[model samples]
Target: MPEFDLIVIGGGVSGITAAAYARRAGRNVVLLEAGDRLGGCCHTWHPVADFWLELGAHTAYNSYGALLALNPDTAFGNLIPRAKVGYHFLKAGKPQSPFGRVGFLEAALTLPFGLGKDKAGLDVETWFTRLLGRGNWQRLLAPAFAAVLSQAAGPYPAEWLFKRKQRIKAAPRKFTHAGGLQGWLTELATGLDVRLGQPVQTLSMADEGVRIVLAEGELSAREVVIAAPLDVAAGLLEHIVPELACRLRATVMAEIETHAVVVPAGKVKLPPVAGLIGGDDAYFSAVSRDYLAHPDWRGFAFHFKPGLLDGDARRRKMAAVLGCEPADFAYETAKTNRLPALTPASVALARELRSALADTPVRLVGNYLNGLSLGDAAVYAAQGG
Candidate 1:
């Protein structure tokens, strides 16, 4: 007999949700994580005991029903509401209002004609361009959305980019956990069998069920769920499902070179705003801690185009943007944020892969299978996809 009924690989939003669900269903489950912590993209950096900043995914919304449902306390009261700050665009090296670039007449003209249009088989550029006119998409939306996705948003599947889901109206429309999103996710994983720093090396089928091979030893489970990054997932599934793994390898993973800094609030001349869209610059955006105020410290995470700048160069640029010097930074860190470069074709691929694995004991979930958002991954995993 298998030692466990289910084994979930990876510890991001997807794996956690899968483990949580299977555990609740009375299955003997254990979660395996490759990293020192969970919450793959819900990464938060704590520079001091009292202050923390988001280095990856910055905001959570009320429409994230799957995530909000995991909250174990008094509903919305426990969530921290973000101050109403807005994202801005950088023009001529100064912060500019997002609306400053909008072409009102162009949008007004296209809205009537683009209404009720179907989004099937379309990319974000095509759908939004048609809906808002080329000028508006070029001037106002393109760069703004790139900042949101931390990549070139043009090729993203229109349908998967954003979906309409029912909102938890009682919760703040945009909020984070008390210690930040990562802290909240840790709380959500409470009591579930989680083993951090346990990276699964490979998988195979045994008489009992699936065998999960790790660096040290191995374990057997009646079922296994893979919730790692695209390439990692592809490599793990290669020997088990050759064809499916080959197809997964065809998809590419996008990387964002993130450089972050924490500085005293007194040194910054940039006003209180959510973030800055890079637009044609060497980066996608600069996300700030302004959404949730800190008494003396302010932090920013600049998601830059890979290989565009070196460490010293990025530090100087970050200081230039923040209206301070590199020396003003009290703390600093760097990380590479990766996501699947998904397209309309990738959506079809997801469905195909899901169907192929249905009859097998191996299950898969992550940002690639669904949309890139944590909530989207949660919803997909909650559905046992």
Candidate 2:
């Protein structure tokens, strides 16, 4: 078995960032990925005739400190170029306002106290009313936040909503890449030895180092970062701490289904808009017109918010939304059970888990531990890895 100074499990942004940090520190680091390719959820694919489609993450907000710190020269690089990035919101199956640079303003005006009673003092609206005054929440913020977060996870808690809104309100006008988010991963993985298709089956701590048993072989590392899915990490830790596994078992429970919807080139006119869905169902989708940026490649992706729609219900909803038969898009679906979520329980469990492993030398990182955003993962990786 080969040995290294650090071994990172999983190849998502979290794991990749960890590997990059360790390698930069002059440590012998090897990244192991179960999939044939890297970029866990940060994936972009350009099919034969279709536009660029992102199977996982869409775009990171400019406020992502970790991502910026990792690559200081943001003026030009792969993270997201200065163009091809815009924001919009949809209401009643139409743009909230007429097209132009006014989309952001329109969204800010309409969505804030999403789905709650128009009268102040209700859940989301109460907080918004406090921010923009009583009636202002109804006109500008609630609907917009509602429109975006509605498709995301749960009701936008007052605290998180305020923080996120402030950040977005102070962000750059446009962002993204001509080749898509894949370039960010490709650049970040440079100089690191990544072993794809290597699924780690077991991991253990030894007096000298950590031992990782993969499907094909075994390897050792002085320190290991368990950046895989919570369940995967819990399974490997069961032998070490069964009680921790039990606590983690009920902490996160959400099966996610991903589908890529192709909008015919020049056929569908989608003004650039991206946000969380509004309503009780919590579905988040980002609409992009410049992922590929070519006249020929036209494509968009819709992601089902974890724990939002059940399998059959989600399929039906997607079919109706896409205006295509179920079978037409069924083949393009990718499903991952136990997708990481930021539920209250999961959040609490993350704190508990962190304390549990604080002195163990095994750092746990992922979208689950932090908010389910590439920015969060990158920030965490840069800060500690």
Candidate 3:
């Protein structure tokens, strides 16, 4: 017999859940992670605040059935009441309604038509413009979506946005843990055979099964599941599975930087709203945190435009958004390449790749395989799709 029934690479949310499912199915599984911590992008920390600050994946909606199913006893932290919701559009350094008067009129006129019947060959920009009118699309929808996805909104397909709308409607209330998402992740990691900092250098097909080569040694497994990012997956499968690697290589990815800044209470009196969305050229589209949960806390979390702002520039953007000098607020930053540019071509290629890998023991599981939410990743990983 091989050393193990399955060897799962990557230790993010998807990988952890994948291993858990495999173990529950009576397979001896081992999970290997390149980083010291298990939750790749689902990180939480407390740098200078009394409450936990999320450096990575923060919230999960009720629609995350797969994640909830995996940890039935886990207690989620708090929920931001729907009535306390706030959204703003930042223009000329001032907050305005997301939809201006003209945009609102346009939305009223066109929203009746809905997102349209055809989603086959339409890009997000065109579909949104048609559904909400040009003014509304430009003023409200585009910037809000750009900030939410951490990438420009034009290239992606309309079907992705349609699915997102369905998810949002399905799960309206978003909840986070008291210790941030890390608390949930830590709970999930328990009772699992997870090895931290054990990065696999290469993978190949062996006569017995799949061979995983690590820096320290090599192991064989009857089955292998790759839950790593597409780029990393492509690199590992280059020689062993060129076709899969080529498909993965064709996937276009976007980089996003998340900043958590804590301002002193009463130092900067922001609008009573929970968050603000910026215009297309604005650095950040949204800024919010669990202000309602911790009434006295002045923490604000921000997501920036992909690949646009770096270290100093990001600091400056944060300062501007918070109406204070960068030195005034205690802040932390985490960069990730988790967002996939799900264009029409990219979506088609992903579907083709899934079909190609359907018969093999080797499987791919992550945000790209299903959708781009933590819930989607968990569902895809747990289902082994």
Strongest candidate by lDDT: 1
User: How many clashes would you count in candidate 1?
Assistant: 0
lDDT of each: 0.90, 0.61, 0.72
Angstrom error of the Cα, residue 91, model 1: value is: 2.1
Off by over 4 Å in 3: 74-83, 99-102, 108-116, 162-172, 291-296, 306-310, 334-338
Residues 206-325, candidate 1, lDDT per residue (tens digit)?
A: 897899889999999999999898899999999877997898998988999999999999999899889999998889999999999998999999999999999999999999899999
TM-score between model 1 and native: 0.98
C-alpha RMSD values across all candidates: 1.1, 6.3, 3.1
Off by over 4 Å in 1: none
lDDT of candidate 3? 0.72
Clashes by residue pair, model 1: none
Report lDDT (Cα) of residue 11, candidate 1.
89
The lDDT, on a scale of 0 to 1, for candidate 2 is: 0.61
lDDT of 2 at 285: 53
Candidate 2 residue 29 C-alpha distance from true site, Å: 0.8
268 in model 3: Cα distance from truth in Å? 2.4
